[model samples]
Target chain A: GESVGLHLPTLSVQEGDNSIINCAYSNSASDYFIWYKQESGKGPQFIIDIRSNMDKRQGQRVTVLLNKTVKHLSLQIAATQPGDSAVYFCAENTGSWGKLQFGAGTQVVVTP
Target chain B: EPEVTQTPSHQVTQMGQEVILRCVPISNHLYFYWYRQILGQKVEFLVSFYNNEISEKSEIFDDQFSVERPDGSNFTLKIRSTKLEDSAMYFCASTRTGVNYGYTFGSGTRLTVV
Candidate 1:
């Protein structure tokens, strides 16, 4: 099945640096995208979301960029902190009824 | 902030035993969903419920699995005759409209079938 995928399985970033996670989705029909952060033993926490009509959206310290032409999405975290160390997933909603297809997560390791 | 709540943080059950996972979605949300993630895998949608009925379900949600909103507040997933493959982290989520509105996920219940 055509699915969402990440470019990197793991990302190492120094604390206080900027971190970027990239994802590629194959389903062109997908119109909604979201970024979530999952810590150990916890549920996925919503970070940011972007609709296909928009190219970019921003939250507290996170930004989601969507490129419909390339079927790509990216999440950027500014001033990465140790608390940001977690597995990040990119999910796309292909249907209006709303079932999300999640990508293999990118493990972000924030190093002090 | 309103959030989804799940009960039984973890469960250990023998194969062929029945298990029920419970969840309390946000009070005002209209849509409910169940998703599962196996070890080292991405989250997979199991089922979606609306208006006290199942709106959609995935292939993994076979005859052994069922969902119900028996009362007005509690949504439950019952797995009959569990198998080892049924062991996974099950997460409950709710949204006001749909995924476009961003779903709030519960901490999840980890089920282990032996």
Candidate 2:
């Protein structure tokens, strides 16, 4: 079975520092990867995504990096803020229509 | 901006009772999906629907679970006989297009089976 997993379960960083979260996926055939932020009692919200064809994609304050060679994916947040503290999950779609397989998730904490 | 909406933010039911989770996806979205997350666990895909029919479904969506698009706006997931293990947060999501667009997820409905 294919699975997506995170290297770390929790991450802590300063308010103004940069944070990077790493994920590893077992299925090399996965063509699409997405990062989601979930609050305490809410559903996951899309943060950023990158296709297999591209190595990296950048958004307003977030960036997603994909390394197909090692089947690794990472999400980088610039200038972490208190509002950014949440559980982050990485998901992979294996050519299924909107069907996503999500990782265990990493909890991001920003220290004031 | 359009967004997905789910009903009954929280539900409480006894074991063996039936439960129905309702969701209304974005008006124009063509794809609909259902996912569930056990407390502290990862989100798992349950099913996907399009064109008034099921396009894909996971093993978890077995005989006890079913989905339907009763009307143009409502998509629902019904569990015939809920068990204690069925307690989890169910999320409904929709995408404007397949593969290219990001999915918009609803707030989620928490089902607690006692």
Candidate 3:
């Protein structure tokens, strides 16, 4: 079956440095993608999103880059902070009803 | 900011017992959804509800699972008979109709079947 997947399971980064998380999705028909942050024991919080028509989108301190040609998605966090330490998931919206298919997730750790 | 609310942060039930997970989506939101994540697994979509009916459902949402919007505010998911594999964290989410919007998710309900 087609699915979404992460390139890395964990990422360790120094505080104040930029962090990049990568994801790969198998379905080319997927039109919308979202990046979510989940703290321990909490639901996923929306960070940013991009449509297939656009290649990149930016938020407060985050940026989402979509590469449809390669079926790749990446989330870049600038000046990573301790609060940024969490499991980040990349999800693709599928079907007319817009049900999201989520990747396994990449755990980001920010160290001082 | 408005938020989605879920009840009973954690629940423990014996196999074969029924369980109902409750949620209250943002008041003005038009679409509601249910998703679940097992330990060490990805979040999986179970069902999406809109216009007081199910707009889409995954294969995981079998006959044993049901969803209801009993009133204007509360949406619920019921499992007729749970199995050990049913243990997971259930999250409720809501979103307004749009292609550019993101869904707001509740904290979640952790169900443990023994």
Model 1, global lDDT: 0.91
Candidate 2: misplaced stretches above 4 Å? A1-8
Docking band of candidate 3: medium
Q: Each candidate's TM vs. the true structure?
A: 0.95, 0.96, 0.96
- List ranges where model 3 is wrong by over 4 Å: A1-8
| Per-residue lDDT of candidate 3, residues B8-109 (tens digit) | 899999999999999999998889999999887899999999999999999999999999999999999999999999999999999888435658999999
Rank candidates, DockQ, best first: 2, 3, 1
**Fnat per model, in the order shown:** 0.62, 0.71, 0.62
DockQ of every predicted complex: 0.55, 0.59, 0.56
Please write out the lDDT profile of model 1 over residues B1-114, one tens digit for every residue. Answer: 888999999999999999999999999899999999887788888998988888888899999999999888999999999999999999999999988775999999999999
Q: Write the per-residue lDDT of candidate 1 for residues A1-112, one digit (tens) a residue.
A: 7344434389999999999999998799888888999998999999888888999988898888998899999999999999999999999986656788888889999999
Question: Distance from true position, residue B72, model 2, in Å?
Answer: 0.4
Model 2 docking tier (incorrect/acceptable/medium/high): medium
Instruction: Look at candidate 2 and give me any clashing residue pairs.
Output: none
Instruction: Report lDDT per candidate.
Output: 0.91, 0.92, 0.92
Query: What is the fnat value (0 to 1) for candidate 1?
Result: 0.62
